[model samples]
Target: MKTLTAGRLLPVLGTLLAALLCALGPGAGSASAHAALTSTDPASGSVVPAAPRQVKLTFSEGVLLSADSVRVLDPQGRRVDESKPAHADGKSNTAVVGLAGGIADGTYTVAWQAVSADSHPVAGAFTFSIGAPSKTVAEVTTAEAGPVVDALYTTGRYAAYAGYLLLVGGCVFAGVCRSSRPVQRIAVGGWITLFAATSALLLLRGPYAGGKGLGSAFDLTLLGDVLATKPGAALLSRLLLLSAAAVFLAVLFGSYAREDGDRTRMERRDVAYGLAIGGTVVAVGLAATWAMAEHASAGLQSWLAMPVDVLHLLGVAVWLGGLAALLAALWSGEPVRRAEVQRFSRLAFASVCVLVATGLYQSWRQVGSWGALTGTEYGRWLLLKVALVAGMVVLASFSRRWTGRLTDGRPAPKKQAPAVRAVQAATGAAKAARPSRKDKDASPERAAQLARQREALEKAAGRRQRDADEGRSGLRRAVLAEAGVAVVLLAVTTLLTGTQPGRAETEQRQSAASGGARTTAPAASGPAETRIPYDTGGTNGRGTALIRIDPARSGNNSIDVSVTDPAGKAVDVPELEVSFTEKQKNIGPLRTALKRTSAGRWQATGFQLPMAGTWQLTLTVRTSDIDQITEIRNVKIN
Candidate 1:
């Protein structure tokens, strides 16, 4: 029983080690062409004097122009822009749209929608004033910047998938073929490979996702940002945890392997220790994969999403890793162990069931539509992956059937006796030619006994040879089929990682709608009404200021603003500047000043409130724009 368990466990342990090593190695998909917005013209919050001739946007990669839309809206929420967006001349990253007349003085918003190169829809808005220059608003909003993060996140995610597949396959093979030393060696090599691969992946992940070149990848700032992001934190945490787990397991396995004299105790310890280590390693691997794929290591959803992601990863590892073990089992010429094979098969089947269920749920969340499966590059690649997985299942089914037959322990049929006899005769001739010195006994009784023993040995050899031939043939076929399926699935998975899933059609429709509205607007007319109200409730009078600026038409213009104190006296304002806040930097200046109007009501003409926001009006009634009076206000134009 001890030997039997060892036979079942050693190969699996070796394969597990391989998976760890491979996960640490250098990864595939080094190209950093994932979709990302780089910059925008009339930046997020700029107070332009006139409606610009055109608005321009740039991205990290060449954008798909047909699936992008840009709109210019007046303070009244009316669309004001005549030109449809056109691909910028000689620039794939830039998209430009010509503006129409009637863009009045006040605040104006430029709303944009685009499909990334990977087919994900990203939309956002920026504001630029025509006349009065208010504060600078950032060109990139959180929503706009989402694509860049998503792209980076996805890249790490798919690399993780590849790593998981490789590791699991290696471990499974090692576990099942423990009887053969050569097989054990291969399994050990696999462990080394997985560890190396995973380590490389960790290194690559930092630079690849953080938008940095390899040279400065380890810089403190870059590392800081990487550490802060969902994928980076997850990778770092899981890598450390897994490495520790692997080392501990290795030590335990070595200790168990060395106690050969006490076979019974050693065998029991080996099973217990192997399971403890293997289970830990498996858990870590699952966690790491989930961390990368689901960004499960970050934020409020981390508790729930992380565990679900871990389970999904675990299911994948068990199924793929178990397949690797089955492959190793088939590689050994020894008769397949029926009970062990059955146990692994059952586990593999259960893992596959879990994988499918979890995978479908995840797909629904990510893909969103049936059209996405074919309409988007990501969808198509995913479909291909599904097809390949189906093929693997068919191959697995065939393997299970053959495994059942091999385990039945039935003798060769009478119809196949002739072939068996031929093999026996060949083995007999070989043995006769290589006779042992002990077989040279000359006494009659001893000679008769020797002959009987030789005959028995010959029969045993024949049976072993017949079993070897049959096992090899069936295993070879099964292995080849499995390999084919694995290759196809790997290819599909690789492509899926490279593509983005979403609708190209929807983007175009939105762009067209935005374009048609631009043609109906008139030209800008006057300074319009720009009202700046201060919220002086908080300490240091640090409350939001509500600034309402109505851009009557679409072109550029400016307005004036003034503030009166509670005493109904005109206040000399200082330290007043405007800016927009978001993930990326884009802010404009509040250049115009308030002039004395009638009595307590002072007015500043040519004041521009670019984008809608809770603008902070900093004033030092008697000093500079940085000291003294500080007031914040929330203002919505349209």
Candidate 2:
């Protein structure tokens, strides 16, 4: 049995050590921050007099760059960029890439991807014209990473969370309660899981950021390049910290256990203090790895946020992870002392307080306003997490109540008696029926005393067993329920890391509304078209209306409109309306007399524009009998 256990454990330890070493390097944190594209030089869809020397990009926050962070491609989808992309003017928030000298005077697409300050990858693509807009521009996908890589990376994140909780919480349980083989195994499992997950993340970062396939995870060149970036460095730091954690675990289950029985009070106290201090340092370092790389590292009041985030993570580990430990102990078929359960309850309550305070601050920073709480995807996930936490708290209350009734409403047993020992003793006595001459020569009084003592011990054991079974039943159920809810809560929390913060989403939408409202410069001989997206609060009510105005100049023009769903498939609607209003001069909102020309196309002829300026082109589309949405875009009438 010993050999089997050691054989099984060897592979796990090997995996943990190998992965941790592979990830050893400099840096701190994970991919938690989001970067937004704030502006671009020459601007998207703008016409410049001559070919520009370089394309410049400015982001909402600092970004980590790579050789191919920014790419410039011609209308034919061919690369036209020359040198590697670099920060403009040594500004971390700005990126500049040189364009090929004397490139064709046509539209060019710029695709960019960069690591945000918090380690998350951000990407986007846009088009600009040198002299004249091309007949057709290449469509560049701005997805941050491939779907497969994203799924795998996200799974790694979830596993990391689970492992951190188990490792931290299990240690706390052993220190606060009594140590057990089961808890030690749980902590070790956590360590191995965390190491594997971190290694997977470090390997996947290159492909994830570059939007490459799963096979790219093994590219050493790419891995080295990733290690140079903040995200890569953060992952490496986490791995190094895990090495320290391994030592802590060794001391926890090995040295600590060996000294438990024979150590003097003073010596035991000293060892405990050492364990406490060392454990604290290890826990804080691990928590800091996450705080320094994620949302807390780059957002508002980051100086304060990082520490608060660490506290929050520690609190979560204690409460949720401790719950796991408690459940294991309850179901371990051993009598759990009331004091231990009470101690954990108090510890959990304190952790809950810390979680509440930190969670509120994080929510305020990310959501900003109540409207955003319901408006954005991140906000909704946060709300769900909050709900799950509340449920867990309710379950915790039940556990606490059950704890108060532990030991069968009696004081804890001074020494828990094991029924197995009594059974072994009884079996030994039966086997010794034919005693040796020395045993037979013993006094009858001595034999009577031994029998009486054995009977008393057996009775005590039976009572303890009954008390334990009755007392822990309710507490076990409550803790199990809480643990179940905690799993779901952790999942939601992991998902939120990948989601855009509500505050960022709101700001991006406002920026788009103000800056990208107008169409590209009109071509010399073709119509000008502006696409407007709309979404009504109904089923299948979201789509885009592509409106084109022929001979888009002053005075008379012909208008055509077509609607397409999110899949880019044309769809017919119940009704469509087109109107134009020049806000500067308070010109008439000349409603176009549009008629259906095909399944999803509408056209109107001889619309009088009267003046040349930026006009608001309003479009209303009804996807269903009652579901309709209206959108307005700024269109040039010259």
Candidate 3:
């Protein structure tokens, strides 16, 4: 009977794993979710009896506020806000701005912009009313970084990624292959590219964040302002680390490379160890510059995500970057040592392991549900990246097979050496026949003939070398194909960084659905009750908030709120605030003042609801010092 061997099973398992991830990778995640507006005081499209003291905004993650982070405009497009936006109640994720006293309100517009913890800028506009909702001339300006600035910034980001891979990979290749000049040149090119790209990004950041044109990139004041923010600070820190990297590179290619052949083995070993440690520090530092400012520093498991992200980047640099160096060495007309190739193969295998483990964890973090993984654009992009990585793995396997053949002493075809000798003999004859410029007896026509013969001999030598490098150059061609796939992989990764994380998009979609209009039939003559589920994404954060409104019509209504754990047990929270808003006639975020009555319950007596319609109910719950969520739901009032 025929049976499946381990080799056959390996491919089957890999196919199954890919299928599983494509269908069920919701638990795999990314920390780079863009910040989402969770709840707002007064609620968008609501009307109030009087102008609010301030407009408050809450987000899913921390945001960096600027002078004009939140702006309130009157119906006539006049600024009515205090101009300085500050964190509400010392909360890093909340922004609040005071409105000018006694300002007449109609359909007032609120425009807000902030840089999220992941270093991406987000902006939005909404309308609310006081006294009555009316037509307003104040228009919401669509906030966006102009096309020219966006394209330039994105290009800079791509260059930065490429430069980092080249710089780190080239250095590693030099260490492993012991072929200094060509690989070192690759490293130097990487450093120059990275340095230039980083400088450009720093200048462009100010304009990018503020949605300004490219001309504003050079504004000194804007640059100063950018320097104060977390993202800007991260970029500045990267610049400093790059300076240290320069020193590291100089030592590696200069003093380290120039070590005398007469030196003792012990001395050489010690010097190599020191360089390894120093290079590691510089490499990890450079990786940290990105981790601190991007997705790793923001979302769930952030404490662990940052370090893992650094490792992920280091793995990519070592494998893809090293592959590039190896490719260059193969085609440089230099004899490549068998041991160097074997050592790099081992390192590449190890790097792939690290990448896989960390990548799965990150994927789980960025995507929390199957729906999110399959439904969002971010998810689609991630799948594409996975497919590309899989292709690379296939190509790598072919390369490994060729490497094994070389190591196992498989004899290459015997035609290579004779080809090399023939080319050398032809080149020698051409050189012997060429006459020096000082030989006045030689005619110009004879000299031209010799030069053409020399060119022909060089071309013949190249063709011969190409024919027998390793019996059709299997290893060389395989590595080349792998390098091509890696280039595409890196581009996808750069684009992924700019896309919104699937988890964030899912949350935003849910928020919009919850806040949408509800056309429920008028309630009977009794209390109207609703149970809304809330998850703050913290410890014991999943639960239901039970709300009941007594005598649910217009005028005064009594509200009672009770919180519960997922297991149906009462759970007490640090704080809870509820507000109601009516969108049709544009009335009320009539906030309720509640007093605690029990371990997980609160009641507000004789609160006014005024005229009744389909109203939005917003509930804010804080579970810990930093864990909180705002939920909005629609309710019908008689």
Candidate 2: give the clashing pairs. Answer: 29-293, 30-293, 31-119
Best by lDDT: 3
lDDT by residue (586-626, candidate 1, tens digit) is 33333334334344333332223333333343332334334
The window of 10 residues in a row where model 3 has the poorest summed lDDT is 512-521
- Tell me the alpha-carbon RMSD of every candidate: 23.9, 15.4, 15.4
- The top-ranked prediction according to TM-score is 3
- Tell me each candidate's TM-score: 0.49, 0.70, 0.76
Higher-TM-score candidate among 2 and 3? 3
User: Candidate 2 overall Cα lDDT vs. reference?
Assistant: 0.75
Per-residue alpha-carbon lDDT of candidate 2 for residues 445-496, written as tens digits (9 for 90 to 100): 8677666766766555454444344457777887888888888999999988
Off by over 4 Å in 2: 1-32, 259-262, 408-468, 518-638
Q: Could you tell me which 10 consecutive residues in candidate 2 have the lowest summed lDDT?
A: 1-10
Worst 10 residues of 1 by lDDT: 550-559
Q: Ranking by TM-score, best first? A: 3, 2, 1
* Per-residue accuracy of model 3 over 1-638 as CA lDDT, tens digit each: 00123364367448535654754544543333577776777776677899899999988889999888888888777899984999988998999999889988588878788889999987766667898877566655535687688889999999999999999999988876655677887898889999999999999999999988988888999999989988788889888989988998898898779968888889888888988998999899999989999988898899998999999999999988888888877766456667788788778777877887888777777766687677665777888888888777777777777775453242344745666676577667657656676543668887677778778877666655654556237888888899998989998999888877878776664543343322123444567798989999998888999999865654335689999998888889998999987665444565776878688899874354533467899999998888899999988765
